[model samples]
Target: MNHQHDHSYKLLFSEPRVVRDLLTGFVKEEWIDRLDLESLEKVSSTFVTDDLRDREGDVIWRVRFGDDWVYVYLLIEFQSTVDPFMALRIMTYVGLLYQELVKQKKLTSNNKLPPVLPIVLYNGERRWNAALNVSSLVQSVPGGLEHYRPDLPYLLLDEGAIVASEQWSIETQNVVSAIFRLEHHRNLQDAIDLIGLLVHWLQAPEQTRLRRHFALWVRRILLPSWVPENEGAEWQPLNDLNEVHNMLSERAKQWPDRWKQEGIEAGRQEGIEAGRQEGIEAGRQEGRRETARNMLERTSMDDQTIADLAELDVEQIRQLRDELQSRP
Candidate 1:
């Protein structure tokens, strides 16, 4: 994946719901059942490490499991290339995390460290061949020192490896898996149905922001090229997920027919090139604007930060803020 795509994945998974869904649905429920999902809290990704090279795409969350708390360390590997030293990398990160916990005085009276569950989320197109345990990387551990080898085993969630036969058991799991499945969708219809599935998952008022963000993703990133710029008249309030699903389904079907008619009309008018250029620019702007708007509504991000994320000017972000406020 490219930087932009990697950044988007980080943004999407940063949400606590996404993290919880991924852990509870994908990972075996034995460990997941021990976790109090409601008590899941995001921990800082940054830790005081002497090596600056440790800074990478990693997300950490703390959750109460019975009487103690456990950390869920998610290593997001976006590069198509496989890292041979992935286990070593995770071992270093987990050590740093344990240090952070100790610094925060989160250990027991006996100085026992909390458990850390390291999970690698690989969305790359290539197959992952990295060693899952640090112990496997030890080249020459003496026979007697075998017990001393660091044996950190991590859970791996390779997006490409996921199949429908291993269906997610919960609503959250289904939506989380569907989001990962979005990039690998075979056709436009599949993508639309996935969006519908996401909508179906949003059952509570607290999920309002998640629903809105998903809508923005579909509008700006997914369907901008296929859907007409002005056909909607205005962004209609989506009160029902089924309604939204039907609307998008219809739009996807209309694209081929619409493109065919537009092609013939462009041949007759000889303004195809100019129209295409204008359409591209218009779509870009609309996508950025919608992205900014969604961030403002769904996140606590400030205008300047949102501007940086959406690649819009600060003034444009401010205008989007005003427009969002003015919405009924």
Candidate 2:
């Protein structure tokens, strides 16, 4: 019973356990399936980059499924739009995680490297199918691999309707429904519950909006309707919204998506920074004189000189300029 009006984007900001529950629900596997996931017992999540130097805690969820002896990364991304480097981002995270494991000696040479599964759960209204997204592929080509649901980091989580429906399971449905409400619902009460749900996940131990709504809905409506107030408890956790938020966020980082962002974005950027894959260039570094002379911007320089200075394909430069012009 989620309404479009009520939504909680900050849930990931608050609770880690609830987010874990959601991930556990979606994957239908123990939090430690991979050896490394269980052994490290860590979930690292953060923003894509520094935003005013304060992380938004937007890039949600990460975990390892194995014993402490070995584990890799299982990352989940919650985004409104598909970035071009989605796959590349996942690859970088998984690779870096292995490096972290090695640095900490949480995993050893004897331990097998775990596969990093990255799932991007999108909430934006537009369909994400595109030439770049691997969702459409049924097979992997040479050098390019296709990701399947069986993979730990597989996505497709936030088609929020089912998640928001309350009819869905604790892991997926509640989270999904809450997200859908952000884009669709309007009721203040509904909004409160969604917030409460997030707060609950955050493990806040106070009178959250859910409690408030339960108080009103039960006393004002459900009690009179002959239903018990306990029904809400079955779904909502009993704690302060803030506590729940922290708890949930902590737990979720145990998953991969969150851990990667923390490494890549540091602790400031919510998620936009997470979009930057290792190989992705965040635009170009413009230097006026590093070249043996320039061209176009300086015709005195030959094409060879211009190419040597910038080291850019002429076509690539043309595309970049065009792309910049198209930006709003």
Best by lDDT: 1
- Please list the residue runs of candidate 2 whose C-alpha ends up more than 4 Å from where it truly belongs after superposition: 1-14, 28-66, 69-80, 130-153, 159-166, 169-186, 193-328
Alpha-carbon RMSD, each predicted model: 13.1, 22.7
- The local distance difference test score of model 2 is 0.40
Give me the runs in candidate 1 sitting further than 4 Å from their true place.
1-5, 51-56, 141-148, 168-173, 216-247, 258-328
**Tens digits of per-residue lDDT for model 2 on 188-272?**
2344446556545433444255433333322222122121233334324423444433443353234223323333343224234
| Whole-model lDDT values for every prediction | 0.70, 0.40
RMSD of 1: 13.1
For model 1, name the residue pairs that clash: none
